[model samples]
Target: MHRFKILFVCMGNICRSPLAEGIFKHMTDNAARAGEFEIDSAGTGGWHQGNPPDPRSVAVAAAHGVDISTQRARRIAVGDFDRFDLILALDRDILRNLRKIVPAGETDKLQLFSRYARGIDEDIPDPYYGGREDFDRVYTMLLTGCTSLLDTAGKLRTS
Candidate 1:
């Protein structure tokens, strides 16, 4: 069984990407597909490396029954381009940054995290500077996007 490797990206690993990683991991685990996927999160910048997800992000995920507090922040690395089958960026700017550093011939692996989301066609908003409401909103958006992303991954596997 070849597991599909996925890495979520945001400005800092302490927020959105970590949330997405946790949410997606929870979804897959609940579905009994956890062994079929490799999920992780990274930031475009190195500022947050070695730290945990922002307190708000941890609290938001916990409120929704997922625990992301154990996950540590890390910066995107050159090897990640070869390691992950898919690299999902939380926003356009992050996506652009990933594109810039992606090795040639690996562009196809990069995509916006919202690509499979039902009604959202843009980046997932950064909620770092906002309040609890912003974190809640981001959690909702990630739930929807992660669900659709799993569906997309399933389809790709079968194809």
Candidate 2:
């Protein structure tokens, strides 16, 4: 079976992207489709490299029964363009950064994570400086987006 690889990106891997990765992984695992996908995350910047997700992010995911505490922050690498079937950015700026670094011929793989979820036509807000409510909001956005993303990926896999 060919596994579809998905990579989520944010400015810092300690927040949004890690949440997306955890939510997507949890959803796929629950659907018994975990083996059919390769889900991971990275950041557009490298400041947090080797660091675990922010404590708030870990707490938010844990509240929803998904553990993202183990995921480490990593900067986006050139090889990721070829490694992932889908490269989803948390916001427009991240997408632009990714576009600037993506090798030619791989631009088609890049997209905004919000494209998957209806009504959420903007970037997932960064909650790094906000309170619990912000993290909760981000978690809700990620959940909706990841659910929609999995649905879309499943269709692509079948076709």
Using lDDT as the measure, which candidate wins?
A: 2
Q: Candidate 2's residue-wise lDDT over 1-159, tens digit each?
A: 889999999998999999999999999999999999999999999999999999999999999999998999999999999988889999989999999999999999999889655446699999999999999999998898888888888877632
Task: Name the Cα RMSD for model 2.
Answer: 1.3
Question: Each model's C-alpha lDDT?
Answer: 0.91, 0.92
Off by over 4 Å in 2: 117-120
TM-score of each: 0.96, 0.96
Model 2 alpha-carbon miss at residue 132, Å: 0.4
Clashing pairs in 1: none
- Give, for candidate 2, the lowest lDDT window spanning 10 residues: 112-121
Could you tell me the lDDT of residue 3 within candidate 1? 84
lDDT of 1 by residue, 57-117 (tens): 9999999899999999999999999998899999989988988999999999998888644
